[model samples]
Every structure is written in structure tokens, then in C-alpha cells.
Target: MTLIAERVRELTGARQPFVHATVVRAQAPTSAMPGDDAVILADGSIEGFVGGVCAETSVRAAALDTLRDGNTMLLRVLPDGAASFPDAPGAQVVVNPCLSGGAIEIFLRPMLPRPLIGVAGATTPIGAAVVTLAGFLDLEITEPMAYAGASAVVVAGLGRDDEQVIRAALDAGVPLISLVASRTRGAAVLDSLGLTAEERARVRPHAGIDIGARTHQEIALSVLAEIVRELRASSPEPVAAAPTRTAIDPICGMTVVIGEGTPHAVVDGVEHWFCCAGCRDRFVAAS
Candidate 1:
């Protein structure tokens, strides 16, 4: 038997998925029978039991071919039977025709990439946005002791002790890291850490949109809206474009983006815009 679990973890860290070939069923005469195991890495490398030179040779070659693209397959090798490089979901591994005589069955599974994110805060908005962004992306959200795949990480306490956390994140090669703070505070935190200007600039801070947020939940909404905005900026997936300007929904405190030329009336030094009559009614009633 092979240390399959460790290898799987390693392959996953490398963002490479491989095929899990197991000798589920076997027939007599062959030295290698059912219950044998082999890890077919994305690179087409095999670790574990080798059934036969002929079978191993062909499977290794086919596995590499599979790595170029993500395709799960199951192969059956017979004492003389051949191997087929089929697709996942229904593919089979047949490596039985080895000089050994027994037939071998191997299963192949493919792995794919995930979106990785490093968040600065996890309290409210940042946490929600990360969970949402991971809707399909590889998300790694990390906190003091929490680690979510390559989601978003919230730098709630961005200070000296936090240096390693940030540095480690960079070392881990996460795709994105967001800092939740005002520009001045963000600068101060970075400066205290003696980070290079370039490093400071690399952080996407300021949390999210500035829509008169006064509560933790509201702050989170603003940040999430900002993240969604950034995501929509380039995503091929369809999403409603946020209005360039948004007014706080006084009743619920939700930032309601108003389309251009929408009706608005100013009062108390702050402008209020509404997306619908109901919202407008609530805003007016709240006033």
C-alpha cells in the first residue's frame, strides 16, 4: 500500500489533481492483482505499485496526457487486456494483461484550480464578501488562527505581531490580499511594520465602498459591494453593474446604488437617492 493521503495533499497544494488508481477487482495468475494502488499525478508520474512494464508504461504515458487537461478516467488492465484513456464521470482503467495474468482496475480523478484570497478582516462585510466570492473562485480566507482555502483574509489587527501572517501569505503566493482600514490608518499600520512602500501599495485596503456606513454590518456591506464591483469589472459571468453613485437607504442603511439621472432631493447636507418608490417612501418616512 502507498501513502496516498499525503500525496493527495501535496498534489492539491500544487494545484494539480491526479487519478486514483486502485485494484478494485482482480483475476488470477498475475503477480499484481486487485487492491493494488497507484497515484497517477498530473505530471503523469506514478507512485505506488507497478502492475507490469507494459501496463505501467502505457498508463504512465496516458496519465501525462490526461494532465495536460483535466479529465478523470478509470482504466482496467488485464493480464493481456489493454488500457483505455477515457474521460471522467464514466471512464475506466483496465491494466490486467500484464505478464502477471490477473486483470487490474484503476480509477482516475481530475483536480482543478481554485481562487485564493487573503482578507484583512473577517468581522462582517469582509467575511461575507469572501464567502460570496468563493461562490466559484478558489477562496482562502485567513484569520488569527483560521485558514480558508485561498479565500480572503481580514487584517483586523494589522500590527507588528501580524508581520509574519502577512509575509507568510505572500510567501504562500495567494492571489489577493485586502486590508480593511482607511488610507491613513492603513499607511500607519504598514509604516509601523517598516514595510517597503511598494509592499504597502500592493495591499488593496480601505475595506469597501464609502456609503455613510455607521455599523459593523453596514461596513461589511460596503466592503462586499466593493469586492463585487471589482469582480464584476472583469468577470465574463453576467452580473448587474453597480450604479456609479449610491445613496444610503436611510430606513435599512443598505447602500442603494442609483442609476444616472434618477430623481434625488438633498437635505441635511447629504444627498438621498432612491431606486424605487418603496425605498423612497422608506427614506422619506425615516426622515
Candidate 2:
């Protein structure tokens, strides 16, 4: 496999979110050629070369934007005063004053991990139905032991260890906690757990939206629909912790995402972040 492909596999195995940036068009005098690629990790580190430091800076910022919106973007990086063609939706134009003279267009695609769901009673009909139906919807069905990492946890045992699983999900801070039970039984079970009012509110006792579901399969459909609703509301998993933040480069006036790998220099007890080391050096020299 290609090195970029291998890195993608490794990240996928680790369930780490990242953006794959590929240069689809490179104008004259550009350092990056068409097909040059790079992997932008969640931490804003670039794994490969798409362009020089200036172009990479713009790509890094745009890549992070794509990660936030869960959209693939075609980023057009042009030199100062260079007019770009009109862009369609999911396309952006960035003017980099530090560019040598040519324009570069890179495709930034965010690779997000599948939303994981934990079912408490995998062998039971309701739980098994969740697993089976999740397969069709491309959701990851994880074991109860891995509930801590799940986007949502469903206690489908119908009273079997319902309190234990519910408590575990609550403690884990899973985004969606559901119990597959009738209204009365679910309420009694939740009350018996002695959870706080807010904690009890977090658990969806009926588990699914009221869809007049009667059979096991129908009920499972409703429950999965509810899970899908929550997923849509949150816009997928692994997007929970990363917040988009950027600062303008003092010298070049380029916007740079504030990350561990970004170049920065402190002057007069005030720290300033830069898009590239060259800009940082210029700022330091002027300071």
C-alpha cells in the first residue's frame, strides 16, 4: 500500500479523526504537483507534503474547517492580488501573501470514525436486533465492556441488569443513554437506581420514539431511528472535543489554527502565533 494509504489505515484502526488533503491542481511556479497529498491529524500536524510552508499553513486552516463542518472542501490558495474563479459550495478561496507566485488547489476530506453504539444484552432479541440493524446503517456495535467509548449505550435487557448498565452509561457520560422497557417498568427501574433528577432525565426510558411499534424488529427500528436522530443532532462522533480556533499571523497576516505544531513566538510577554516559521522569524527579527 502507499504510505498515505497506510497512514490512513493506521489512523482508522486507532479510530483517530483526520483530514486527507490532496492537491488536485497546481498552477505554474507552484512547488506542489497534482496528486501531492498530506494527512492532517486532529492535532493540526501535517504528515506529508502538499506544498511549501505558506501553502501548508492555509491548507491546515482549511482542513480544520472541513473537520468541524464534516464537509469535503476544495481549497484554492492563491497569491496576493490573484483573482480566483467563482467557487461552488464546499469550496473556499484563500489568499496567501507568502506564496511564491502560483496557486494550489487541495481537496480536504475529513475522515471521521463511525459512531459506536453499545448494546447491553447482545444475545437478547432487542439487543441483537440493534446489532443487526446497526450493521445495515454503518454504525459500529460495540460490546458492553467498551461502553465507555460508545456514543450511546442501550440497556436492552428489559430489566436484566438494567440499573447496572444505566449507571455505567451515566458515569461514562455517554451522549445518549436509553433503556428498552415499557414506561412503567422503565420508570421504576430508573427510580430504583437513585439517580439525580438531571441524571434520570438523561436516560430515555422508552428508548425509541413513539412509532406504534409492536414487534421486536419494529421496536428496534424505532430505537435505531432515535439513535440516528441523536447522531444527526450532534453531527457524528469524535467531533465532540475538537474546537476550531485560529489566530492571525502577525507578520504575514495569514490565519493559523492554534495547535501544538503551529509556529509561535513570544515578544513583550505577549505570545503571537504564526502560520509558518519564516513569518515567526521575521516577527522575531522585527521585535
Candidate 3:
């Protein structure tokens, strides 16, 4: 258990998504005892043992589901004949015939990485202020070149080399690019870069929420606020209803457009869709 805990900490530090499955309860004939734990990696590999093969299978399936949707779940694995036992509210129930009449309840918790913001061109006071404000806002910050993995990049170069910094950030494929500069200067920089209209549109000039900021700190706060808004907009919202034109893949949690050739399955009277045939096969096998 201590080793598993240490591994979990290591994985968390690496910003890798994983599921920690802990056996909260166990009935007689179960191979595992309460308090046993396992770490399920994003690739569906199990590093520790929570139960025997049957129970572990269910745990892996539930852990994958939790990792895909970023949801914590209480998974109850019972023998096929034990279906009469009432499952706890909000618990995911899996009936496995190979459980040998034993039952196990495991809690699956998904650990996802925090959103990262790259602060580039920090040589200027404005850039430094943005970094400081980002820290205060509990946002993780990285160098400009390291922004490739970041959720967004804020370029605060308010000098001659501002265009260079912005170009580097854009080439890194950073989703959101916020440039701190006057409208005239930003337009001049964009024109000089010879970027396409679409690429130019990606740059947010004056890079902040419209709070009429004047000082560096205020500007930094506004920029952080805008970043927060972008993050919120990118996050997956609850689906009020399953659209006929699109469906979420159960295996990988990817939103798939439903079309003539799209992969799909009907499991237990519920329609499940997949982005690819591989995901569809995996979902069928798991089910």
C-alpha cells in the first residue's frame, strides 16, 4: 500500500492521468480485503492488485470510465446471482460470473493534470507581473518554448522583440495566444509577420479582459481573467440530451459525430457510440 501511494504521488507530480482504485468493502470468499488498492494507468494497465481476475477486470473497466470522464465512482462488483442486492446510490454496478459469489466495492478516483499557462517574454515588467499574478491565481506557469504543452500562452513582450516572441508561441501550437501590446503595434507586428488571416485571428491583441486596466498589475489580472474564461469555455459541459448528430465515446470519452459510417453499439438498451472502430471494439469487449 505504501509503495502504491508513493507511485500515485510520482504519477501526480508527472501530471499524468490515472485512477486510484481502493477496495472499500469486501465480502466473504473475496480474494481481496478491505483497504487493498491498485493504480490503473491511462493505458488500462494495473500496477497493483485490488482483487482477483474477475474483480480486477471490473475495476479496470470502471477505472477507464472514470479516467475518460474525470468522474469519481463507487464500483460494486458482484457475482451474477447477487444481482438482487441493492446497489448503493450513485454506485456503478458490474455483475461478473467469475467472482465466485464474492463481492467487492472499489472506489475509483481520477487524478487529472492542472491547466498550464505559459508566460513568455518575461524580461519585461509586464511579463513578470503576469507570471506573479498567474501564481496568485493558482495557475501553473512555464517558459515560452515549453508552452507547447500549455493550455494557453501569454506573450508580454512590449518591445522591439515582441513579434519574435509571439511568433515562437504561435509556432508551438498553443491553443490560446494573448499578446500584450497597443492595437497599432499589434497590427504592425502581425502585418510584418505575413501570417494568414486565420493565424492573425488567433492572436488576441491587448490580451486582457476589458476592465480598463492601466498599471502592469491590473493588466496582469485582466489577462488572467481572460485565461480563466478561455479555460472554462474549453471544458466539457454537461450534455442536456444526447444529440442525434453527435455522441460521446464510452471507451475514450471523445465526442464523435454520428454519421452513416460511424461506429456504435447498443449495450443493455443504451446506445453507445465511438470515435473509432478500435474504441468500439474495446467497449464491446469490456461490456
RMSD of each: 25.9, 3.1, 8.8
Model 3 CA deviation exceeding 4 Å by range: 83-87, 123-126, 132-138, 214-217, 236-287
lDDT of 1 by residue, 1-287 (tens): 24876776786677555666665554564456666777765444568774654455446544554555456566665444433323346554443222345555565555544444455444455455545554544443444533434534445443434556565555554434556677887666566666556666545656667899876656656665665566556453121222234455453343343444343556687777643455556566667
Candidate 2 lDDT tens digits, 44-85? 789998999889889887887777778889999999987665
Predicted candidate 3 versus true structure: per-residue lDDT over 1-287, tens digit per residue: 49999999999788788899999988888889989998987666688889875466567667777776787999988887774345589988877654667788899998777678887777687889988887887778875577676778888867747677678777877778888888887777788889877778778876889898989889988988998998888775211222235566676554455545567899999988765677788888998
For model 3, what is the error of residue 173's alpha carbon versus the real structure, in angstroms, after optimal superposition? 1.1
Off by over 4 Å in 1: 9-18, 79-89, 92-100, 111-114, 128-138, 142-287
Tell me each candidate's TM-score.
0.43, 0.84, 0.73
Q: Which 10-residue window of candidate 1 scores lowest in summed lDDT?
A: 236-245
| Model 3: lDDT of residue 11 | 92
Clash total of candidate 1:
45
CA shift of 60, model 3, Å: 1.0
The lDDT leader among the candidates is 2
Candidate order by decreasing lDDT? 2, 3, 1
